[model samples]
Target chain A: MNPALVALFMIGFTIAAYIGSLHLYRKYRRIYTTPVIVATAVIIVFLLLFHVSYETYMIGGKWIDRLLGPAVVALAYPLYQHREILKKMLVPIMTGTTIGAVVGISSGLLLSKWAGFSTEIIHSIVPKSVTTPVAMSISESTGGVMPLTAVFVMIAGIGGMLIHPLVMRYSGLTHRIGRGVGMGSASHAIGTAASMERDTLEGSISTVAMILSAVIVSIIAPGLTLLLL
Target chain B: MFKDKAIIIPIQIAMLYLIYLAGKGIQNLFDLFIPGSVIGLLILFTLLSLKLVPEWILQQGVSFMVRHLPFFFIPATVGIISYAYVFKGKGMLLIVIGLFSTALVMALAGRVTQWMVKRREEA
Candidate 1:
């Protein structure tokens, strides 16, 4: 297949998946558990069984991934539109993100060492709390594979999404501000999406926290990795 | 929905190309410094915050991308296939440690943040 043709097909498939998932989400109103997960699993399984190389897939997929940065920036408009509420909660949001980023990196390093993981793996895992791009960069700078960091970050996001509600219930943490910051800090973009589905205020707060955590982690991870390792 | 739909598609394509150009420009500038995508996002955020680009233009493109963002990761995920042999040894131990420790830290971070917020609220 021509690379251009493959790219077109992949874009078509991606758009179709998005539309289908949106439909299912609207019907089910359970954004986290349904369409996206099912679509991702099915497509991934198909790709794997067919022996599609990631590079080949990415010949098309990179076009989509290229937009991730701008998309993140686009999040600001919705955030800006809701600036009044955001202004009110800025203190809690900033404080929560700072605390979350610190604890996340510290505990990850500590626990991985305790579990007998090597320094490289520990370095990779510690930044999983940040968004993927930042985590991958941090991992690379600290002598970990960018690809491996990507995987760990995705897994962290999925894990945070799956378990957060249950954790919230168990811990009796119900305030939207607390929940939003915790979700954003722990899960990055995925958790931000989950919070958005819950409410606009929650989503905006989570977006702010998520971005702050990523920036903070990027700055702090490299220095900390040197000291700890 | 249909009226907006028609406009959204073209606008999204245009915005995506513009973002691509912006990203490339950023990458070029930062290639001498750091990686470009990080700088590109920062630049984009700055632009958006400054209202240099209209929100509506970027919003559709962003919405389109975010909705299907996971699919973009499929290629990266499949890279694990080539590493299966490499992963057979100590790699397994590393992955186990990595996944669980990352999760544990994430949970701890969430809990600690919540605690700090609670303490602040009480004060």
Candidate 2:
């Protein structure tokens, strides 16, 4: 089989799968149907079923992966756009997110240690609470498995959304600021989406928290992971 | 979305790539621990805030990338297939950790922020 042909096929197939999954996600709106989750599943199944090696997939996959860095850099746009709200709630948001970042890193590290998981797993989960790109980068920098880190991040986002109501009820997180900060700080973009669906202000605050937490976690997770782990 | 001005999109993306390269150069030069993308984000952010880089330069390109951010992650996520051994028996444990830690962080962060807001109002 020609390598160029394989690369082209893999690239086109991935795009098509993502588009189809995106539609399914919009229509059904379930965690399992998330475009990335669904698309990855579809691709992985296709690879396994047809006996396609990950290395072959990477021939084309690397091109898509290359864009990830620039895309992450582009995140500054949203962060910049939301500067007004960020300015208004700087103190509380910062206070909440800093604490959240510490708890997020420490809890993952300690729990994995208690469970007897290996160092690799511990490093992966440490940055699980931040957004995917940042989390993946952190995972890479820390010698964690990038794929496992992404999966843990997805789990964290979904789990945070699922438990939002219960946590709010028992934790007295009634205020919109608290709700937003909590969701975004803990869950990243997916939690921000869930928060948005509940309240506009909460959603906006969640966006701010989401971006701010990324910066906070990025700066601190490496040092904190070493310190606590 | 750009209508006939579509050429601008790639150019803007190229501009972003240049910044990413600059960030990587800095990371290598200083032996910094942070990823170049994040450093690039900070550099671009500072440029935007300081009015050195016009927002319009990044408008469409950045939006396109951000909107389809999930798409870019698909390949990496798909790479999970290779890690079967790592996750084979730890499914339950991972789920428990994911759920528990997430809940705790959400509760505590929310509580602290709400408490601060309340105290500020009282003051």
Candidate 3:
């Protein structure tokens, strides 16, 4: 297949998949229905069935990936939009994110070790609670595979999406701030999506937690990795 | 949404691209470890706060992009197939521990923050 055709197909396939998955997610309301998760699954199946190389798919796939940076920058609009509520609870929100980062790293380190994974895998697991872009860099610097870190981040995220309500109900961690913080800090974007489903304020708060936790964890991940490992 | 406002999106993307470029430049110059997009976010926030970049200009575009931010991550997630071998051995074990720890982080950190908020109210 020609490179240009491959690129066009890749782009068309993803856009089509994204819209289709968006509908499926809204209708089916399942984790597998998540636009990103579903789109990836569909594309992977397409690649395998068609015998296309990942490299060829990446021709235009990379273009889609390139949008992440701008997408991230776009996040500031919401944070700014909710500036008033954030200002009132600024200190508590920061406190929640900071404490969440500490717990996330220490627990990730200890649990991975206790489970008998290698040091490298353990390192990757440490940043599992942080957002993907930040987690990828931390994982690479700390001797973990970047791709593996992405996987772990997704698992943690999807895990939060599934279990957060359970944790909130049974654990008595039901404060709205706590819910937002927990979801944002632990699950990042996936959890934020769940929070958005609940309320705009909840979603905004989760956004704050997600951004703050990423910054905090990235700053402390290396130093703590040195201390703990 | 961009039907008649086609120019808004292109302009918004261009401005965001410029902000992102400035962010990348700063990251390279300062040798920072943080993601350039984050710095770009801060820059956009500052510009908005200062009234330098009119909020209305970027409002619809940015919000639309942010709403579908998850879509931007699909390619990277699919790239996970590249690391399929890592899951062959104790990889499942590692994932279990990772997931368990993520749960703990949420429960514990959230509780701690709630405690602090209660303390502040009490005082």
Candidate 4:
């Protein structure tokens, strides 16, 4: 009956479920089994079955959410590791990221508008291309639902991975740097991880693009959303 | 070796948390539009680049966090439980928007970068 005990249970359950999901993903190597989706699904199912409310779940969930900030800050270490390549290819990376960032925001807004979604949903979709923590914060500041933003971001990442081959083959994206830029700028962390699996150079370059895209999207999403939506 | 890790990893994580807090404080004081975490990321990147903070100090803890980064997002993603009504009747539309926009951005950004990189090589 103690609240703290329930909170601890929820936290432990989440970690246990995640470790299991991670194992499944490593074994199966399927998109559907991606640990984030699998772990979230299992936890949601458990809560619904037990009649636990989202608010109660958050007593523990919020603690995990709190670490998201430091995890984001840790992204800097990878960027620092690849600083030399970053410096050498700064111009092209910036150009590609700026273009990708603008298109990503505008196109999402235009499409969401055409679909007749509310402004709040539009705001969520606007930052869907950036990294999760950054996107969630942007969504919060812009009057969007943070959870929906995360879902939209997940969808974007998976979509990018699925269609990347077709896009790369037809678009003549041969260079590792270009491939990395496209994946990171458009798909964020999920894409970067997938790119890492495919090629180390691309994976590293995607790291740069992912971080830069986050910075650029955070700066631009507010003003751009105001203009479009 | 095990004892050293036991001491260092926590300290490194603590240092990261301190930077994150400082970033939040700066954001509040300056009225910046950027999120505190991102501000923290930039600060850490600057510190790493300037060699003010040695890489070895934060390397293990940072790598551990980065490796399991997706784990942190699970809780937030599960918050979708409360917003199911908002997404009803809009699932197909959102999927279409995500797929279409992602593909477009990838192609265009890739093409532009490829062109620029090729031009540089030719020059």
Number of the top-ranking candidate, with TM-score as the measure: 3
Displacement of the residue B95 alpha carbon in candidate 3, Å: 1.7
Model 4, stretches more than 4 Å misplaced?
Answer: A132-151, A157-174, A193-204, A222-229, B1-7, B121-123
lDDT tens digits, residues A23-64, model 3? Answer: 998889865566777888898899878887778889989988
Q: What is the clash count for each candidate, in the order shown?
A: 0, 0, 0, 0
lDDT of 3: 0.81
- Chain A TM-score of model 4 comes to 0.80
Model 4: per-residue Cα lDDT over A170-189, one tens digit each: 88888998999999999987
TM-score of each: 0.80, 0.80, 0.91, 0.86
DockQ of each: 0.33, 0.56, 0.65, 0.64
Q: Give each model's whole-structure lDDT.
A: 0.67, 0.83, 0.81, 0.85
Among all windows of ten consecutive residues in candidate 4 chain B, which has the lowest summed lDDT?
A: B83-92
Q: What lDDT does candidate 3 reach at residue A137?
A: 89
* Chain A accuracy as TM-score for every candidate: 0.91, 0.72, 0.88, 0.80
Q: Which stretches of candidate 2 lie over 4 Å from their true place?
A: A130-180, A187-229, B1-5, B114-123
Q: Candidate 4, residue A211: CA error in Å?
A: 3.5
Off by over 4 Å in 1: A21-32, B1-4, B16-123
Q: Per-residue CA lDDT of candidate 1, range A48-140, in tens? A: 788876677677777767656555655555576677766765776777777777777776777767767777767777788788767877887
Q: For candidate 3, give the DockQ.
A: 0.65
Give the clashing residue pairs of candidate 4, or none: none
Worst 10 residues of 4 chain A by lDDT: A192-201
